[model samples]
Target chain A: MNDQPAASGTPASGGVRIAVDAMGGDHGPAEIVPGALDHAGAHPEDQVLLIGLEAAIRAAAGTLPPNATIVPASQVIEMHEHPALALREKRDASILVASDLVRRGEADALITAGHTGAAMAAAILRIGRLPGVDRPALAVQMIRTGAPFVLLDIGANPDSTAENLAQYARMGAIFAERVLGIPEPRVALLSIGEEKGKGDLRIQRATELLDASGLRFVGNVEGKDVTGDLADVVVTDAVTGNVVLKFFEGLSTFIFDLFRDEFRRSLRGRLAYLLLRPGIARIRDVFDYEKAGGSPLLGVRGAVIITHGRAKRRMIAFGLGVAAETARTGVPALIEEALREDAARLDAAGAGAEGRAEETTLDPEDTP
Target chain B: MNDQPAASGTPASGGVRIAVDAMGGDHGPAEIVPGALDHAGAHPEDQVLLIGLEAAIRAAAGTLPPNATIVPASQVIEMHEHPALALREKRDASILVASDLVRRGEADALITAGHTGAAMAAAILRIGRLPGVDRPALAVQMIRTGAPFVLLDIGANPDSTAENLAQYARMGAIFAERVLGIPEPRVALLSIGEEKGKGDLRIQRATELLDASGLRFVGNVEGKDVTGDLADVVVTDAVTGNVVLKFFEGLSTFIFDLFRDEFRRSLRGRLAYLLLRPGIARIRDVFDYEKAGGSPLLGVRGAVIITHGRAKRRMIAFGLGVAAETARTGVPALIEEALREDAARLDAAGAGAEGRAEETTLDPEDTP
Candidate 1:
């Protein structure tokens, strides 16, 4: 998804305002309240709109700042619930209320570590896609690199269409440029291999379409390339990204599992862990998500960030920080410009195709 | 495919000889020839034969041991060629000759690092699968915890059906217990989540069959559990494993990329890399493939090892080590037990149904 530099050519507001789903996440109101309070306490310049049951929020938050207040949300979206079904049924859900605050102009952005699909659905139904956006995607930050790598449709579209993937490339480029601030960002389509004919049919069509879309396409990249900063925007359908993301997580954990095993080899080895705690901690930070918070649902008219449902208090605070940073930069405006360019290019292509059809008529068998 | 410990199976003898494909891999005959020399030097301990182009083998190996001799092969299988097509056409291919050694009763096992698919195809066509094996599978060790996690079908059958997965699960368990000495090695079907209906249709059906297979079926596991010590044997189609395997490589590289970025942040950080060299080496060790070598083509009539085509001297040595270990323990004997168990169950059920045709109903559903 997209995070912009807060101004996408919209009116500038010095103080950033964000609506956070304090009742969501594994830690619930307990972590959410603390995260909002923590962000408010640290960045007093920003306002946090806490959306959840009033009593529950106040009970966890204790004395919130004058810049923060409870906006009652009657429903709750469970992490395990289906996205579309939950969004349709849970009208006053905290995610819904949070998105509504952003839609109504009461808040600059909304943040949630609840169900990603439900959050996306709520953002789409409430905030809607930006004028040129055909589909919304989850653009996650690869914290391993100091620079961000946007992996679109992380869990949004499991089965991607060629056209949708083409759009994803364009939208992802805008997000990377306007939000992450990488000029002429390298945009790549994730595939099985770097070879031209390596992937399935969708990738085949997508490669051609993306190349013609004029969005700085960098050909096909394998999953390993995603983490190495090989490109700023590594594009793929949500299904592929989801698998890759989970695979990365598993690898990191596998590394840790290996560490524990080595640590237990003998008392002498366990001593090494104690001596090297700082170095190990530093390495851990390189892979930590707490530094970047949540993924943004790009292509939406308004800013809506979706985090993991299993997030704790620290993650919520990071999410808040991310929302504020996004609100400060007007990312929506850049997306609009990119969209207009895409439309004009498509129009010109259509005109060119029509002219070609009139001049080069031939039998199907003889054409090749 | 089939690697069971043959408690009382026929033993290989009668001047059995194997012609090693010496001029292969990244290090070529330099490593392969030495490996052949070592294997031949230990002939009395472990019986086998060696074969390659005579000139190259002699030049690289410097007078081989008495137990090994050169057998001429007209050509070699390059890593870059398509394996299936190459094996079908290249009669005097080195990998083919290695398999031919087994076919001619000159060798009991064939090993190569050229093309996995080509090596597998050559062995299957030349040595063939055991009489009852329906499909052959590749089993490899995924070094995670101190103990290795044996995974099957890394790229053997990526698009397998439910029954194919069932067969793999059985085959994998047998390999683990017989070779790795894990008693009734716990088996698991890999998927995206732990819930009953979390994965694709194949996984769901496989899960049901595994549950009833009377094997030590450990329930459904997420992607993370595959590399952990949660299950002794994890079963999946080759396509998924190939994808997952590449993703893991990417993740590890990503980790390295991040580490490099951290080290380059400042002069002080660069110093940290030097100071933390020991621990960093430990981290690197976690991702090293030296300890994890070639995947064994199980279920085939003879033991065949498929090392990575990119093998360096160390990797080739490790692959040979794995082959020696497999042969020493007689892993194929375990394959026979699992196959026999499955066949016996099917036979008993079929016999019971024959006399009670009207009373007994044929169930089309393979899994719950």
Candidate 2:
């Protein structure tokens, strides 16, 4: 049995319960249900709630494990449907029901590989946000240099303000410290240049705020330095972060296509590729986003992992592993604790902390 | 012997005159002088004015070719010096002198593999801006997929507005059409998503403007689509463009490093790499920054190309080639003509063209 207490309510079997949106993503329950059941079989200490149309889940997963339960969700939000409108119309959508489970403390975490906008909306509208947290950030790990680093606000807040960025840096630092096992993560602001004064007005002001903040501020970092071993947490506005992340996603595919084309160009190339297949796969594995599982939506009240829309069985299982780990470690609670301390520190410094904190405080109903 | 006239002044031998900043960049005169001489030897129709300390240029080149001339500059702008401050203090700096030559019509084009900030400053302060042009942009070519495309505003104006980005699109399209040989170049705005409304406020506003601007507007393209030939010209703010460009630079190096380490891991890997070296070189050649030569500083009144600061003899030579070609094509003159017509179209459409044109007009002395 598990000794860890849930954030609000008791678990069904004294174990971590992860509610999965089986009717989400491209393949939906066909891929998600089996992955959830497999994870449940592997980790008996964790219970998997496969939420979807009950018949679809049962058909996809012929025989579910003892630790897996089917939580029927009546509707599925199509990928192209407007997220806010769909959520409003489809009350029993899988993503909504999964998020509701986390809100009601029936599940410790929620994992979805479906529409990203819908997932974020559900997390904010149902799971709510940590106190004093203006917005939740999507933090993805970059392992290009063989050492994993965190890049946050990847797509959550396209119009992020300096304060939002500062908050993201703090949240990102907590993620790195707790999940990545880094003690006091060195966070850096992503700018055009490595110099502190080289960025735009927002980044310049953010630098000053970060310097005054209690976190280990590593100053400014450029795009070139992000892949290097310079800092553990790299923060940027969601616009830049999202573009950078997509570029990375595009690059892997581009480079691999280039390799394949080159290898097929000649007999020698084909022979060489045959010999170097292992090496190529090794390099591919290092930069594989699927192997990194999912990006965590930090600053929310519960653990939420957003996997790729193209995620399959293996990726879903890996995402479940991340969800379980984050839930067990109580990353959301840790972030809330850190933000409270940060607020207290600002109060001690007499920096108008009370008013600013109030301005960022969000009510669950405020989000769509 | 030559027929193409200089922008304002008669060439020494009725041929293109490119002023090369010999004392700028990491290698300075040692790499620059030889590159200029080699280019001068190859392009008998072009004149190369090597601008630097006379003694240093002579020492680096040993002897200059007939088409190459040494233009003595007493001062050199160090890489780390503040660009505006350095341009004011060191009036005879190599980069400044190069820009001055272009301004006075003594040189048809200016090419510098120096401090990028200094290169832009010199272009703006000494060379001046084209008529009705608000700001100049740096446009670089990306050839990752073996098809080259232009990405603009790489590092020119970090605080770019909607108008600035629109101008960049026009300039980038011109470059792609005339230089890169793309007919009616498709221009796209770089954003977080491909939808017209997917970007920030500036981008969304820019989308509306671009749709009305009468170019081959391709709505919005995300970072993932940049390298894939979705558009010939991709326009963005300097901040995002610079980050994407630098990320590409970093990715090539990182991927190659991974390949090297992976290859060295085992005997089979080593043998495989030895055989695949030729194929690898081909892939490397396609993505090489040095091969791309330089980024054209569009919107300046004179032809200006900013090469990499790490330029060696070969890269410097390639930069000179680009400068000569851009000058010969009269890109700056074409841009001014196009803008005049654009203003006319806006005037006919009753969009307050006169006021906007007047607002954007830059006096030569207004720079630096």
Top candidate on lDDT is: 2
Residue B117 deviation, candidate 1, in Å? Answer: 5.3
State the lDDT of candidate 1 residue by residue for B238-291, as single tens digits.
545555666777777766665566566665556655655566678677667766
Candidate 1 lDDT for residue A181: 78
> Tens-digit lDDT track for model 2 on B104-223?
778888888888887787777666778778878899988766568899888887778888888898998888887778899999999877766576777777777788788999988887
Q: Each predicted model: what fraction of the native A–B Cα contacts (within 8 Å) does it retain?
A: 0.21, 0.50
lDDT of 2 at A81: 84
lDDT for each residue of candidate 1 in A1-368, tens digit (9 for 90 to 100) = 23322232353367788888887777789888888889999988888889989999989988888889889998899988866667767788898888777776778878987876577777776766677666677878775547768777666654457777877777777767766778998888776556553455566667777767777777877655666667788777653566566767778876666555655566645665565556567788777877668888777766678877787888888888877777777666667677788778878778444211111111112200
Best by TM-score: 2
